[model samples]
Target: MGQAIVVTSGKGGVGKTTTSANLGTALALLGHKVCMVDTDIGLRNLDVVMGLENRIVYDLVDVIEGRCRLEQALIKDKRFESLYLLPAAQTKDKDDVKPEQVKEIIGRIKQLFDFAIIDCPAGIEQGFRNAISGADRAIVVTTPEKSAVRDADRVIGKLHSEQIEEPKLVVNRIRPNMLKTGDMLSIDDICSVLQIDVIGIIPDDDYVIKASNNGEPIVINPQSKAALAYRNIARRILGDPVPLMSLEEKPGFVERIKKFFKLG
Candidate 1:
């Protein structure tokens, strides 16, 4: 059976959807048959992020309501042969689908895919519960801010209480310069507070925005540090011993030339 992993955050705007899209794409690139499920319901954006917005004829709700078959609701990715998307209903509210229904849907999909990556809704509400109901593992995305870390702590506790122990952590939007200047929290600080293993550290890169705006995930961009970070995360998910990328910025052409000539 495929592993159903939920990508969640206790707070919104922490790159949960972006992580889901990129990680699913990365996994598919690594030759895994991956299916991404958007459980955000009314505010569904995974379809847009994966550039399948125009292809979403049947959504998760339709599948659960028996309006369509699971295969009919799956939107196949044009870029990746093994990647598929099951989008949430944009017109329906979060309360429209119950937790058991989401679990049943995930259970059905697991039989056909190598991974079921669920993009969970923000906050620890019913939406959150529904997203995690069928998950074998959970990836909690957060920034290195106090509020984000605090919320992650709360969410981790909730996951543990619900028997989803040892949920992995992804520190998103990391600014190395800010960390060097002591302007932002370090990864160590966040990990120390959350007490969970850090699975990924995504750098703050403008390429992420450009890719998302173009309906492309940054993981496909070879030049993007954020992309490399997410790819590492994907490998880690597969139990690979990939080391985390160094958070320092690489020297520019001029700086490299100066260093080589010993003229600095």
Candidate 2:
């Protein structure tokens, strides 16, 4: 059976859905059959981010409510043939589906895909519980800030209490220059507080905004720093020992030449 991993954050606006869309896309690029499930219900946006909004004839609610078959509800990606999206219902509330129902839906689809990535709703509520109910692993997305880290810690605690052990962390929207200038928390600082292994570190990049607005994931943009980071994260998920990208500003040609010549 495929792994069902939930991409979640305790607080909203921390790039949980973006991470889900990009990571699912990246994994598919690596030859894995991936499906991204949006469990945010009424506030769903994964379909839009994946550019499959208009193609969604049926959604998660439709599958659970028996209005459509499981295969009929899956919207295949236009770019990658292996990537699919199970969008949440925009017209329904979170209570439309219960946790057991979510688990049953995921269980049925897990056999057909290599990975099932659930884009969880923000906060600790019915939506959150339903999103994680069938997940085999959990990926907690957070920013390198006090509030985000604190909320992540709380979410991690709740995950463990619910028997979802050893949830990994992904720190998003990190500014290396801000960290150097003591204006933001470092990755080490956030990891120290959350006490979880860091699986990914996404840098703050304008390309992310442009790609999302254009209905494309940044992971497909080769020039984007955030894209590179996310691709590395995908490799890590598949047990590759890829080093974290150097977030510091790259050295100029002059500096590189000077270093090559052993001169200051």
List TM-scores for all candidates, in order.
0.98, 0.97
Q: Candidate 1, after superposition: displacement of residue 88 in Å?
A: 0.1
Stretches of candidate 2 exceeding 4 Å from the true structure: 254-264
lDDT, candidate 2, 1-264, per-residue tens: 899999998999999999999999999999999999999999999998888899989999999999999999999999999999999999999988899999999998799999999999999999999999999999999998899898899899989988999999999999988999989999988887889898999999999988998899999999999999999999999999998888888999998998989964
lDDT of 1 by residue, 13-114 (tens): 999999999999999999999999999999999999888899889999999999999999999998999999999999998998999999999999899999
Record all residue pairs in model 2 with backbone atoms less than 3 Å apart, i.e. clashing: none
For candidate 1, the 10 contiguous residues with the lowest summed lDDT are 255-264
Which pairs clash (backbone N, Cα, C closer than 3 Å) in model 1?
none
Cand. 1 Cα-lDDT: 0.95
Which candidate should be chosen as best, given TM-score against the real structure?
1
The C-alpha RMSD in Å for every predicted model, in order, reads 1.2, 1.3
